[model samples]
Target: MRQIPTLAPLPARLPDSVPFVGPETLERQRGAPFAARLGANENGFGPSPRAIAAMQAEAGEVWKYGDPTNHDLRAAIAAHCGVTPAHVVVGEGIDTLLGLAVRLMVAQGDRVVSSEGGYPTFDFHVTGFGGELLRVPYRDDRQDPQALVARAVEIGARMVYLCNPDNPMGGWHPPEVIEAALAALPDDILLILDEAYAEFAPALPRIDPDDPRVLRMRTFSKAHGMAGARIGWAIGAPVMIRAFDRVRNHFGVNRIAQAGALAALADTAHLDRTVAQVAAARDRIAAIARDNGLTTLPSATNFVAVDCGGDGDFARAVLTALGDRGVFVRMPWVAPQNRCIRVSCGPAGALDAFAEALPHALAMARQGASGG
Candidate 1:
């Protein structure tokens, strides 16, 4: 018999889990590729032409490492935010930045606060770093900001996470509510404010950069339509920003991605156009759901959550039927919220596939319920 080395206590104790299964993995399992890809909240409109051009131009420079300091990109992000480069930290993406925040702020057994079925990746990060997670349930399908603050204080938490224009449910609170949450949070607890979908939701409020306890995360992945580029940045007080450097991968941001993200940031017209396209696609999705007798929640992000008019089992059956019919979509992992299936905005062709698939999927779900 062969012997293997043992993992450390934290890694060993943790179960093998992933935040989501990729579409490719699903295709492999089903022995077919999906006709419409809409599950992951990715922007299907794609990145700006200018950004694509910049990445193509920089393709030859892939032989060299990206700027370790991420100087120019950080400067551009700072300029956009009306802050200095010292307050910006560029990373591979918000996912990596989230992990970094967990590592730096959370020691083993420290308490962290988040929504019950919030962005699962953040929860994965917290647990991976050995932090104890306390979750507050959604109030009226939206994250209850006051409840989050109260939990943080009651538990003496080290960090709190809030996703503005949230995922899965696509619900958001007005800026004043977030401001109140910030005020209510204890001084020592850091608020990791994720604004990845901010471009699609104009009504949401942006926080002041001067606040030391708040770190706002932004991404080129959503409105800028550079998900493949894998680039994002965090804006916070200078001291908090610098702490990321201590544990972050020094050369993590690829050269081509940096070039693409910089160009994307410069092209405001492209961003505005993309946002409009997403809004239209969102409306189309809602209309299709209504046509099929399903209602949709108001969406601030690039996706809409369609209420299945049933329980979690019913929604799961609908999602499975969609998969079987070559349409890829997702749903929330927990109850009340899990009763809705999430659909991402895409080109007319993709949504057409979805529109074609929904009626058949509904039929299958209903039939299964009757034991047919």
Candidate 2:
């Protein structure tokens, strides 16, 4: 008898599917454009003009591959962060850096720790590499450092993941609390702090780049509004940073992206201005939520998570209603947290659409729920 044509078995620990379906995919199904793009926690304010100019000028150089060493960007980022270039390793956004972090530390079946309802990208990486995931529940919308540390200890986890200014709920733990959490972590277990929103959040707790047990990952995607550029990096002890090179796509950071990121880093004034605007927009979203009788989670990042004061069903309905109304948005993937829909900080016009849509969407969701 001939063997089955299947040449290899899928990894048991890998998820059997793609977990996140983007708003664009939904828009495609609906056959229309969204009036307000408040979903995906993106900064619609866009990248700096300096970065754009740099990218445009460098466009002619696209014929050349990027410096595989990522020398110039690394140097620029290092100087800005006050770290030595040796302590930094750039990749195709923090998502890729995270995958490298996981590969460097985790063997198949090695348990990893992250907040429940935290960033999904990290979870995707964990599953992709066949690591066992253990999620710590959030404490009042903020990712609980205490619970995460306890779980890390109990599970003998190889890695502990966190997003400082978190996604979905958009809550943050003050820096002192995070320092306390770090002190509690077992030295052998590595902490991968996802700081993609660091550019937007108020300065709080900071992890030393040279910290032996921590890897701080930041991205150009968020505050830089350079999501398409796919530029991000990790800061850690020199040896730990070096490990990423072993698994990273050496020439993955493209030339335009490198030139663009360098310019973005240089344009700190634009970053500061963007952060301030995001803060105001966050306040605006909160006001809209309140006007509609919803509670908005406190967020240091460029988004808000508005609670409809109901179950996941109601929240999902709100999400669908919002989508149907041409106001794209998202909610947490699981219970309790899923009671809220997340909205990013877009321009004022988008908020106007949201302010108008919130009441209508809620009414529609409530009516649908009543019918059932």
The residue-level lDDT of candidate 1 at 68 comes to 94
lDDT of each: 0.92, 0.88
Query: Ten-residue segment with the worst summed lDDT in candidate 1?
Result: 201-210
How do the residues 1-372 of candidate 1 rate in per-residue lDDT, one tens digit apiece?
878799998988986988989999999999999999999888889999999999999999899999999999999999998999999999999999999999999999999999999999999999999999999999889888889989999989999999988887998878889999998987799999999998887676657787889999999998888887889999999999999989999999999999999999999999999889999999999999999999999989999999999999999999999999999999998889999999999999999999999999999999999899
Question: Candidate 2's error at 306, in angstroms?
Answer: 0.4
Scored by lDDT, the top model is 1
lDDT agreement of model 1 with the native: 0.92
Candidate 1 residue spans exceeding 4 A from truth: none
- Model 2 off-target regions past 4 Å? 1-13
